[model samples]
Target: MVLPALMLFVAVVLIPLAMTVLLSFNDWGQYKGIEQVFILKNWREIWEDDYFLEMFLRTFRIAVLATLITALLGAPEAYILNRMQGRWKGFFLLVILGPLLISVVARTLGWALLFGGANGVVNKALMSLGVIGAPIPFMFTETGVVVALAHVMMPFMVLSVWAALQRVDPQIENAAMSLGAGHATILRRIVLPQIMPGILSGAIIVFSLSASAFATPSIIGGRRLKVAATLAYDEFLNTLNWPLGAAVAVLLLVALVLIVVGSNALIERRYAEVFR
Candidate 1:
């Protein structure tokens, strides 16, 4: 039974990945196009270039900030949603997930309109509320990309925590309350510990997705700000540098794999007793 699935995985995922990695070692020139020769030119260029360094830094920075925002906000929202009863819960859940129902491109374009220059809707609203003295730049900025990504990735965090909440025993909270434990104490000791795995899982999901995201970052960051995904896109499509693009892509894959593996190992170690 597992053999077929393993074969499918190798065929669909491993084969393509291996091909791309090999391609990254090939040579490419403007006039010569792609040459099937094994060399470190693409990898060496990425390693030595400050532009690639800054772009990768920007990519992870946005991903980290977006992950933090989702964890901070989504965890609490999940708790609240879990506590609610009846039809209202479903209605609110739908509202939370409404963004996922829409097309990513459409949602990003909507953000672009709201973030339109100094006279954008978001800026005007903030100005009217006296939140700032002047218009803040949202279009073609890292700030805009982070905000949009947080919104896009929020549902995954909420759903993960909500699933964890299901495994929690409600009687534990009541029992603690009857034993003279304060609400804060009960929450801090009992609730948060139980839900920690969920939060970590959600963080991993949001971080990985944000790091590799193309559409939202492309639309909001625009030409001014370029992350790894957009940079890879430009290399392949715009610059016609297939080997270089493949190198960027492989580097991104390696980085995410390391991060995800490290995170999973830490979570398993920390929560080993709890899970067992």
Candidate 2:
């Protein structure tokens, strides 16, 4: 079973990634050859491009926001779930994780329905309440992208925190309480310290997912709020510049790797110190 899965990763992920990294440096076209030789030109072009810069910044910002939101909401829910018994906890876990099992298109479309154009459900409610004269622009905007990505990434955070919370010995919390630690003190000083590893792991996972998401931003934010993923999509699909798209794709991968490494290092250090 594991062998099959590992081979799939090499096929679907590893080989393609290696190719992308190579293509990012060299000029690879459909029919073109060495005339368009390898250099730093592709990287230079990306760095100088306004669209690339804007979209890169927006993607990073949106990813951070979504990751943080998921961590904040997921941690508490996971903690609460950890305290639940029997099938109720399992049932709630299913409820939280269910949306992730659905297609990105379906989830983003659901948001679009609630926030699409002037006649969206959310707009209608806002208008009826006289909160605004016009529909609040939700779809095709950064706000929309962040909201949808956060929702999509919530499961990653919840599952991580749940695992961490499970590993925590209840006796530690009981001992803290017996030592006259108040509820808030117990949570802040004891509970949070123990669960920090889980929270950090979940946050990093959420960050990477949001940063790499293509469909969520494209459908929910439309073509207006282009993220790094959408930018890569346009480069390859719309402009037919496979080399540029591959470059952008490589950059995305590098960004994810760096974030993952940095987050893990920081969290591991903190985890070590707290437990010590």
Error of 2 at 9 (Å): 4.7
User: 182-228 in candidate 2: lDDT tens per residue?
Assistant: 98998898889788888888888888888999889999887877888
Write down the TM-score of every candidate. 0.96, 0.87
As for candidate 2, its clashing pairs are none
Task: Give each model's whole-structure lDDT.
Answer: 0.95, 0.86
The 10 consecutive residues of candidate 2 with the worst lDDT sum are 28-37
**Cα deviation of 179 in candidate 1 (Å)?**
2.6
List CA RMSD, all candidates.
1.5, 3.0
**What is the alpha-carbon RMSD of candidate 2 to the true structure?**
3.0
Best by TM-score: 1
Task: Tell me the number of clashing residue pairs for each predicted model.
Answer: 0, 0
